[model samples]
Target: MAGQQVYLDHNATGPMHPEVVAAVLPYIQGGFGNPSAPYAIGQENHRAVDRAREQVAGLVGATAGDVVFTGGGTEANNLAISGAFLGRSEPMRRHLVLSAIEHPSVRETCAWLEAVHGAEVTVVGVGCDGRVRLDELAAALRPDTLLVTVMHANNETGVLQPVAEIGQLLRDRGVRFHVDGVQAAGRIPVDVAAIGCQSYSLSAHKFGGLKGTGALILRDPSGVMPILQGGHQERGWRAGTENVPGIVSMGAAADVARRDLSANMAHGLALRVIFDNLSARIPQCWRNGHAGLRLPNTTSLCCYHADAMSVVLALSSVGISVGTGSACASHSQEPSHVLLAMGLDEQAAFCTIRISTGPENTVEEARWAADQIAQAVERVRLVTAPEDIGGCGEDCPCFAHSSR
Candidate 1:
């Protein structure tokens, strides 16, 4: 295992669990019949899809029939946001409410609604801790607001929003609510009934399943129309031929997550504890997001005067991997919108990095990664130190004291 990398970026995506891969192998190899066909083999495949539906439903306290499989979390979010507006005929009820810290999938979908459909969008900002300001949300709500879409957990900072409270606020008002639970589903305990969201999105790959598979759990599918139309699959809620192997793996992953939820959470928290302890000793290392209300696996650190990209590259060279921000938006030169909305200045946002751990990570790995990160930060500082700051070399006590 020499030079093997330690992966600490689970929020971006996760490796498939052993059980999930085993469950999907047979379907990938030989279960090639179309679920829509009437032949015996097709019928067997149809049953497999049904069983998957139930397994996914069980993860969120939903019924099998309420789950509509989609391409991934992005599609599920788009369908939930757009389909809600398209299904209704009222031009007056065109306003949509969303959190500023939402994933790009939800944020961009709302932007599309505003640009193409002439709908009004109300974006409520988050506080310094990265939790949505509930008061601002309440003030932004109007009678014409069609639906409120909030993510259960933020992707970059892993801040857990007050989704259950938001749901309760909108529940009696007859307005629909959607929770993009892509990051929250397998990492934390999620109950669709308990959260009381009308629609919830989940990505299979996020919870140790294969990519290219996801589902939208709905309370009532009658209220939402299909985003893609042509085939009659997913009871017409979603169209196209099913991904049999991916669907099977998603189910297997969900089953494993359901059984290991508590243990997995504990494992993640252990990693975070190590990170927090190490971060305390690193100069100018400020932790972002809510301390107690954040995900157990995620720790967002902002190192003043140290470039985030440099830290990422330095770690990569040392056989450790982390993220600067959301992998989906990493291609952009712009700093994270989530961090900016949380009141971080442009420079601080640029200096931020996210470390999200998975269940397989060991304590030794965590400690080693922490030490390497500290060294990398020191190396970057030494290389970039200004000439005016004399004697601020790697061993300078004055520089270290000032950084504190």
Candidate 2:
């Protein structure tokens, strides 16, 4: 934050929380022991793992027995969807269901299953408002539908899905439910028991914890299988050497997030308001997500004729950290899949850029970021698509194709 460069890309990956760093330091320095060993040091490591499990469970209104740790949200998601299908009996339903706005982990896995494992998958579409409609899913459901994996919130938009209704409908239908709570678990409260979902996925880094640590929370199902084949770990639900330090950091991060959630939410909301007001000052700027119903710290904005890649570079050059839709989509020339799913044309999606705030960012930084963005957009618009420049005089496309 030395210059004008302040990171506003919390959704992509957050700076590790201080509490999380404190929690993992001992493990990194000297507490390096295998939790599976019988020695005292091993016991200390195992105890740390247990404590982290309890903390994670407590944060999400779950019991310690319900949590199974994994490498990250992607692993948690794969294990939840693929493992559930594999755990079921032969003649298990052949098809799967999920929302179109789901993260790549969910969507792409389903695609793999269909292509390789003989599972048929259907994606329920979202409305322009960015929320999945329950009726569409209900219509897609069949006796052969083995599972439904819907994200609890859209990562790009931060719009919460109608989980309660989804739960109610799936009740007693023989179809399992898995919610991707990665983007929502710490940013918002999620009660798996309340939602009646069989499985929920979450990652620590999305909520200020270290990367490479995620959890798959499962209800007391009659059976669930491990996707990975390895030595006894994660109750045989996932097998590998435990990520002890990362788990400890995740637990500490969860503790802090739970205790300070209200305050964080309020602060983020205030900062978002300021960002929104600033965005409104520029002509032709449009917010990508549901304006009022979104994560407190995120804003994905679209400006006419503005290429997201160029806007990100221009901002970075001036010391404002942000993300174009580019990195999120693997630097592809394509627009946002989330935006397209919500009915935006490719043009609007391509023009989108996201700014997400976090605990470390200050209101002052948010203000400066907004001003920088407004100015950057005016310049980016001229370079990327001169035909779309309406508010300001046009002349600079030098940074239009720069790396984000």
**Stretches > 4 Å off in candidate 2:** 90-92, 386-404
**Tens-digit lDDT track for model 2 on 194-299?**
8889999989998878899999998855446788996888778878999998899889999989998999999999888877785578888888767777889888
Report, for every candidate in turn, its global Cα lDDT versus the true structure: 0.88, 0.84
Error of 1 at 32 (Å): 1.5
Instruction: Give the range of the ten consecutive residues with the poorest summed lDDT in model 1.
Output: 385-394
- Which regions in candidate 1 have their CA more than 4 angstroms from the true location? 385-404
How far in Å is the alpha carbon of 126 misplaced in model 1?
Answer: 0.7
